[model samples]
Target chain A: MSIQDEFSFINQIKPTTVHHEKTLITGIGDDAAVYIPSPNQSQIICTDTLVEEIHFTSQTMSPFQIGYKALAVNISDIAAMGGNPLYYLVSIAIPSSWSEQDLIEIYAGMSELANSHRVDLIGGDTVSSKDSLMITVTVIGETEEGRQLLRSHAKSGDVVFVTGTIGDSSAGLELLLSKGRHGTFNSNEDFLIKRHQYPNPQVKIGRFLSKLKRVSLNDISDGLASESNELAEASQVTITLNANLIPLSKELVSCDSEGAIEKALFGGEDFELVGTMSMDEWESIQQDGRLQNLIKIGTVSSGKPEVLLQLENELITLEKKGYNHFKK
Target chain B: MSIQDEFSFINQIKPTTVHHEKTLITGIGDDAAVYIPSPNQSQIICTDTLVEEIHFTSQTMSPFQIGYKALAVNISDIAAMGGNPLYYLVSIAIPSSWSEQDLIEIYAGMSELANSHRVDLIGGDTVSSKDSLMITVTVIGETEEGRQLLRSHAKSGDVVFVTGTIGDSSAGLELLLSKGRHGTFNSNEDFLIKRHQYPNPQVKIGRFLSKLKRVSLNDISDGLASESNELAEASQVTITLNANLIPLSKELVSCDSEGAIEKALFGGEDFELVGTMSMDEWESIQQDGRLQNLIKIGTVSSGKPEVLLQLENELITLEKKGYNHFKK
Candidate 1:
């Protein structure tokens, strides 16, 4: 089917299930989508784009995974801002060779995620590309009045924390490239692969944390080291991370890779939240079973803006930061 | 400069000038841009993307023009909804070969337009593309309660009107491909070239028209014939257009190209607003000197959804509808 036919099919199926918002004036099938804002709700918006070869290669990624991860990253951004995911606009460019079934499955992956998060697939544009498949998802979310989080809000004496484990995705990519040629994998390998393919955005945890006052937040997208430096620079405070205190899954350690800490520090696509809050707020969150594993990894200090890594009583300044797209 | 460094530069410059809404709690420099929507206002959002080879070539389009046109098309979508353009999120994928100055100029073009419209550049992600340059812009706007215009609202007797001339962009493309070999051009050619490069979205006019009741609207990005048919199909009405009544720029007509009318009907990238309203409403609009040239070229009727082109003596069914991205 052609692009127009595919759009018509998508319109008819309504694959995405959106939680009804009374303020939404219109949904789809127009030049733009319209909705009314709820009283005292602040709107938060962010956009992320995924390219074919640069982001993920077809050798290690499927069409469905691509769709899922594209939306997942944008949702992660919203979560970092302490906003509830509401609506998303997706723009996709497909090559001529892609089959209609591939496109449909891609949308299905996105719709499944959207349904779980209660985000409405409001409006987007589809076009033909000459080379690769690219998807850009723009998410619009809202938070209660004065409840939004920012990277610039971290203060001295706040304890830095992170949700879940890190560096699994980059390790999974490494495994796919080096050992996948043998075409066999064990159970732990499979788990790592799935972790890389699908990341769970900490929306629930982010919303829970937003209620607490005086917190700074950011998602670990470009790796812990890069995001930590960003948070420190934005807040004009120094952040020191205990490299050993950083949480690592047994699966990651058992994988037996050298430079495991470095990978966790500099790799990209973790999709986990890392932020700083006072000890009192952190202790209160620790009481809840849902956040029992939220690990305290460092402390915010009053100093020149920088990120320092501590290992075995020695402190080292970071030399190589996280992934930079334009750096050769 | 690296992508991160470039983003830092953008943050320092704050290229986008946003019309401050009292509800906006935060703008840029964070995980997301936050704004509180005013009470009784309906939010409108739309997104559009432009690719390297599919949209234009380096020979015909400067980096600044590419950036300008990329945002212009999205702004046009908002205008079609009769919503005021507010904040925009831009996602751009750049190849490694591009210079930092090229990237800066691109943002300058978008900034120039954003400042004029008072839309804030909130937050976006930049990635490295393997091959080409691709940019996506998403614009968020709002209208007063119940003032949003839609294509599905065209009534059976509503008259169809178009702002500005049609087919100039496509005509400019033909000129660029056929006769622009030596890079020398006449005054008329220059006018057509500029029309193709810089399209002025009718944002002010759309905001004005949104207050009127029972109006249908769409921007003529694909062409008059294509948008008219879209409006008709959406509203389930028959639209008939007078071929001679469709306005064409004198520069386009004097270019002496064959099939000028057909180009006006089937060519793409016009970026003009074509919609339907009552005759009374049209007359009232005509009384305003700003809207004196809003040409009425067609009428809506209750019939099988289709678009017909009327010449001097014959009414011909439109066979070549518009540019479909996936059509062979």
Candidate 2:
């Protein structure tokens, strides 16, 4: 885009109301954004990039969904850290082939989610790219002092739980890839597709869990197997997951029990909360009405770092086979 | 790069020490990095993207220079805002052709600069790209409350000043583009090429200027002509720059004066500070021995928002003709 076009695009997406006006001294239209941090709060920051073709195809995702998911993934990181996302910066490299309208739609998608969580768009860059479109989002968040959750805090005998269904997103992606974009889908297929296109980061659940004593948390970005392995390795413990207890969406299970289980084990991009907590803490969370969907999926044990799946009567080691960008 | 490769790269670049241990709660190897903000300080944040071929070609820059320039530009933004850069996040999209050693060297370039400023590498993402490499850096900084310098704070009777020399970078770029990368060069040519490859962001000068009574600041990333117009328009004033007074490096002036003037006016990526301050404040800063290189280039006047260049005997309106990514 021309400099004028870039400026116009920025003006279009410039936020009208900053959620934390007291803290946000400057948002857009400046060399850098300025904000006053809330005293005694720990700040959370993370960045994620979405490259066209590699992350999503136009056939499978609209520009709106692409933008929404880009920000959603960053927010999910903050959720995994037990923080509330407060501000975000987006740097988008656009190809000449894309229209301004498409860019605006993408920003709208991000704004919808940002407005919901009161996150403000602070500062970003808009530049032209030679070919594919790329969006990199950096989110800044905050939580109470010393309340940040981590992957290394899982203790032996902690009950492992996952919030909401797993494998739905990967199943959705599979359906989209197998059946062309224009194909009509049943209600189940539509739900699965939506799951893939629009992920809801578990911010509230993460915050609630962070308030509990002695909890370790991780977001299900990569598959359960990979994430479980990470948590186990970080905590230096062995995690045993019950195959039957792994949550699967009804739509995912309808395909085939074995296939759904496989997807749950190795498919990724679920944006769900998975963590280990003391049994008493888990029991206390179970009594909360909002956490009804929380599922007990495994147990942590003091042993050599590894992830194991309890399948039928056999104990099998789970491999880290989630999406690897350079694995080919 | 496989998942194993990505993990190994992360391990390689993982920071050994955090500069601000009290505020930095978490650094790398986490879902999101956590830090505590300095009490009562305003946080400054900005992001910039450097795209392959568009921003720099492999022919024009080494991978090390590419990485160094990527973070430097973002640091320049924070400097422009009168803040001390403390932490940064980098997201790099690599092509299959790049070796692991090249990536490591790129990180080393960034680490060299980061260590000088005591800035910490907080968090980032490394992913594979289909073709060209793309690097985006987001910097977080801070300044004392309400001390941010802005583009809109200049007033009538303010004297416009530029820190250090201008046009050297663009002149360097011209030499590189015209003579090609491997050609032998004299001392002047070497100096110009180094200026193009490595820019020093004026962080100290910016902080010094920010402490003044009132100053309007901008970094010359997009040429003085464009930046002058920005300050003029933002402050609702007219800026008149004296062509005779525009600072130029000896190497740049070794070329024709007209050509040097052209480069000084419209060429960019200097990362030098440009601002307007009250004549008294300017005079006070001039007395500082370290600020001897500061040049009085223009004056701000109350008039229609525009930029004008005062030539030998006439005043000509300067158009916004800086580098535009999509102008072609």
Candidate 3:
């Protein structure tokens, strides 16, 4: 198909939510889509960009996988905020030699993930590049009145909880590298690699937690230890994490689990939920069936925000090192 | 700085407009942002990407220029839709070596443009790249209640009006290339090079035109000859241009006076508004002080969308040969 037809088809996929009551204005075909701001509910907008080398290696991953991961990562951020991800816009740049088939696969990846999650691809821009590929996704999500969680609410003597297993991405990366680069064949591989490729955002979990008024939440894109540090800094309280309660994968047995622990605590791109709960509500949290697997990684303290591990009856210090967008 | 401090700073830059009265729940620094769909207004969303070496060459432009141009281009899309721009989000991927100074300049450029247009930046993502830089901006704008303009609204006998001088960007690009190749410059030049460096979107003019009952507008991001064809195709009508009335630039005129005609008609990236107006209210438009400079460049007809140039009383065919994003 011609380029015009491709853009034409792309433009036709506007936001399908019918807003015939309020002052509904513009959508997809325009240069910029306009919408009336929600007066009753505040508008929640967030954007994230993924560089080819920094986020994913195209040599090993398929175009569709990359595309899906791009949207999924950003959606995870919204999930951390306790908001419902509704619409997303993507900006993609690729080499000129990339055929239409490649483009279709890339979009197919994004569409597959987005469709399952009910995310509408409202709009995006695409242009040619010289060398590597880059994709940026901007997600728009919303929360109910007073239900949106913020980092400032965690008080002294609160409890910290995290959802799902962590550090698998770091472990997955170690395996990929030890096997020596992108396309290293691993016929025995299953969940670890898939977690590395298509990490799921805990959307329902975030929404469910948002309704529990006393907790503050944040997603662990940059890892639990780092994100917990952020929560502590944001809430102005210290955290004492139980070294034993941190979850691990079965593959972690006989491995450098300490190093794996560090990776799970400090490694970036895990995409899990790290949250704060009040002391009173913390006891009730143990009784909740849906949150039974939600592990208490730490507790908010009265002192300066510090993460300490109780190892064999002695408290050991953990470093606050995590991902940095720009570091030499 | 702490993550909470970052959120504190980022929260200050959100769009506050009349459309802010409805369903969007919240924006930024939360687990997930929430957006309640409006069943009233038509929601339009689009995304675009710009890459190094393709959209702009780093050797010729600074990071600030790149950043400014990125948002400006997206804002131009809002202008194309005849919408009032509200806010925007940014996602950038740059190499590790890119300095803090470079980021400051880039944000300064973007902030200057955004602030001048009263568009707040809600939130964005930053990631490092291995090679070149990539910047993506998504702008959100809104039209007044029930005043949205559309390409589908153009009808037979509506007069076509185009704002500002066309092909100035093409002329500016030529000057830029000349400076690059020859290592010499036109020191007296003012508007020519600036046009290429900073494209101004006619958002206010677009919003104003959207108020008119029969206005069907789209910005001249592509060449005038090309956009007219789109408007015609959308309206299911033919178009004929008044060559004498087509706004021409002095820089274009300086480059072989006769050739100016061709450049003004086909060269793209002008960011000017091109729209159709019905004859019913043409008298009031003629008397408006702010709109007097708007030139009536063409007329709409009943046949298939075809461009014809009226030169020296001769009806000569003007083929649609303009910006093709894929081919270019």
Instruction: Return the top candidate by TM-score.
Output: 2
Better of 1 and 3 by lDDT: 1
What TM-score describes the B chain of model 3? 0.85
Q: Residue-wise lDDT of candidate 1 within A1-328, one digit each (tens)?
A: 3456644755753634458568667877789999877778899999989988788777777878888888898899999998898898888887877777788777877887888998888888887788888899999998888999889989999999998888888788777777652347787777777777787888988898888877799998889998998899899999999998898877778885566787789986788999999877877667765454578999999999999999888999864368766662
Task: Write one digit per residue (lDDT tens) for candidate 3, span B225-307.
Answer: 88887788778888889989998877667754766677677888888888888876565777655465578888888987777
Pitting candidate 1 against candidate 2, the one with the higher DockQ is 2
Q: DockQ score for model 3, please?
A: 0.47
Ranking by DockQ: 2, 1, 3
When 1 and 2 are scored with lDDT, the better candidate is 2
DockQ, Cα level, model 1: 0.69
lDDT of 1 by residue, B168-214 (tens): 88888777777652477898888888888888999987887888877
List the candidate numbers ranked by TM-score, top first.
Answer: 2, 1, 3
Candidate 2 chain A least-lDDT 10 residues: A1-10
Identify the runs in model 3 with alpha carbons over 4 angstroms from their true place. A1-28, A34-39, A180-188, A254-258, A288-293, B1-46, B58-60, B181-188, B287-292, B311-320
**Better candidate number, 2 or 3, judged by DockQ:** 2
Query: Per-residue lDDT for A1-328 in model 2, tens only?
Result: 3244566678899988879988898889889999888888888999999999888888788899999999999999999999999999999988888888899889999999999989999999988888889999999999999999999999999999998999999888888888856668898888888999999999998888778887788898888998898899889999999998998988887755668988887888999988899887777766765455679999999999999999999999998777667673
Best by DockQ: 2
- Please list all clashing residue pairs in model 1, or write none if there are none: none
